[model samples]
Target: MAKNLDVIEQTTNELTLAERQQKKPKRKKKKLKAVWMYTLLSIFLVVSIFPFYWMFIGATNDSSKMFTNPPTLLPGDQFMTNLTNLNESIGIFRVLFNSLFVSGLYVVIALAVCASAAYVLAKYNFKGKKFIFTAFLLSMMIPYQATLIPLFQMMSDFNLLNTYFAVIAPQLCFPFAIFLLRQNFLAFPTELMESARLDGASETRIFISIVIPSMRPALAAASIFLFMTQWNNFMWPLVVLNTNDMYTFPVALSSLMGLSYIDYGQVMMGVTLATVPIIAFFLTLQKQFISGMLGSALK
Candidate 1:
């Protein structure tokens, strides 16, 4: 009986030791996996950041040095020179103002129009509502390239060429904005709207006083999207605005590329300057942007 007991005790100790040995490999494997994931993420981050770094470097280097075989990785001391050259080449402030005005106007008008339309689609029951919503979704799938020629022709017929209004007016009908606003509206609590209505508020009042206030984050998100789209707009503006004085920032940047004597440093400086406002805007509204994204996922 004693011998049998000793053997059982020894067997149990060996099994425990084996189990610990098995767990050790799993723990090491988990650590290795974590390390590999981090390594991949770091590589991806570096790849994404490298272009901005190169752009900054280019802004500091003269044209001759820009394409040097051993590219300058360090920030050079020529940033001021580049800035001066850029200002001399073009009135940076004027171009900047034009971009801001166009983008800002588009953001406000597009968001307002889209939000109203979205609210109607999401809340109101009407004949052919499903069809209309389906159409809006279908429009999103259609590439903008397909409509460019027709749109350009219409603009030509309207004689809106070279006008900011031309750019702003056409984009006010964006289907994507409508869809985004609709989704946001659908996610909104109907109880709030019902309460407002019960308080003898008019439909418009309910929308303006109750709905709009609650939709601040969604509006912010939409505004950012519209602003980015308009600010980065190149093709339509290029087609519509023929003159340098009315050129948007992107158009002006393109013009810089065409000079018989191209200046890489000055071009980079303009790019940097042009990007600053967008970055600043994003930084300021980042909280709202995040909230808007979260709001979308609420329902």
Candidate 2:
């Protein structure tokens, strides 16, 4: 019996050692894989951020240095000069005001219009409902350039050219906004709306007091999209707006280019400034935007 016990103990110890040896290679491979992944991600991060860093460097340096051999990797001392030149070139304050005003107002009005339209489409039954919704979706497939000529003609005939109205009017009934909000609205519980109705809540009250509050995340996401669309709108505004005073950031930035020479420093400065508002806007609503998009997808 003693001899058998000793042999079994030796066998058990050998098996455990063998098992640990087998796991060692797997653990090493996992660590190596993780190291490689991190290294690749670090490379990508640097590559992706390099352009913005270069832009900043350009903004702070002279135009001539932008093309120098070996390139200007560090920031220089021309930032103030570039900003002053940029202001003189485009009247940055006025251009900023125009862009901000148009984008802000568009967000507010478009949100209301889209949310109401989406609510109706999502919850209400009426004649030609599916057709109207389908039409909106099909309109998304149409090239925006295709409608430009007719929209321009219509705006011209209405004497809305060179006006903020022209800039804001054409995209007020944004199909994509309606569609996004509609999807989120569909995810809302119909039973809740019914319960509110049973308690003497009017449709308007239910929408204002309950629906809108509950859909804040969706609204934030949609507002970000709308704000970005109007803020970055170049082609439509370029076609309609003739005066420099009415130009938004994109149109204003383009004016920095010239046939004779381009001021890279000023151009970079303008671009850097123009990027601030968008970055700020996104940062403000990023949490809600993520939640809204994820919630809608899950629902």
Candidate 3:
């Protein structure tokens, strides 16, 4: 009688377990989707980073070694020669300074202008507000090339050609920067600004203390974009800067390949060096840049 009662209890337990399993469906969809997502991301990561590795290897190897069949995958002893050639080809310090100074200044000024304008457009009610923001969006729609000639002529008229002012000025009023920052500013709590104002905080103080601190991500994202644009800017600088000393890094590097029989190793070294600043800037701000990117759309 005891054994039969024990068997009956075990049978009931088995049935209950089977019923529970039936109630909850298997969750394969999420797991499979995750697998596919990870695979795609890994592939993208490898593809994006592989070129930098290849470039670094090329930077180390000589032209002959880099050009070999089953191209060189390892570092070589020719890096010093490549560096010497690169420095000789383009006075490294001059171009580096031009790029760094112009790009850095452009980013700083653009952030201020864009953030201020965005704040006004987003938070304040005024006449022609819609029109102004519409114009900003419209500017982005227009191809930059269409306005280049007129802008170049204007800069020439202003006697800003071959000057850092030319490179830095035109880009300070960046349409995209304005648009991006405005989106972030839209999400700022109006109450906070109003409360600050009630406390006798001036507009500048309110903005500096309240608005800027809250929108770090947007500012970081804008700074990265502005820096990248100004740093890689080639055509305008080409038109403006006549002297080799005045040329930015990209312009100076391109001049190397314009010569017959390109010493690819030297070119790679210059490319590697030119890429360092951008990488550093991105890495430093990548967290904010990524987080802030969604502020406009999400809000």
**The best candidate in terms of TM-score:** 2
Best-first order by lDDT: 2, 3, 1
* Model 1 lDDT, full chain set: 0.87
TM-score winner between candidates 1 and 3: 1
Better of 1 and 2 by lDDT: 2
* lDDT for position 52 in model 3: 93
Residue 210 lDDT in candidate 1: 88
Off by over 4 Å in 1: 1-31, 259-261, 297-299
lDDT of each: 0.87, 0.93, 0.89
- lDDT (tens digit, per residue) of candidate 3 on 182-249: 87788889999999999999999999999999899989988998899999999888888888999999
Provide the RMSD of all predictions against the true structure, rounded to 1 decimal. 6.3, 5.1, 5.0
- Give lDDT tens digits, candidate 1, residues 2-84: 99999999999999889879899898999999999999999999999888888899898776788777877888889899888
Clashes in each model (backbone N, CA, C under 3 Å)?
Answer: 0, 0, 0
- Give the CA lDDT, 0 to 100, for residue 8 in model 3: 95
Model 3 misplaced stretches (Cα beyond 4 Å): 1-40, 293-299
The model with the greatest lDDT is 2
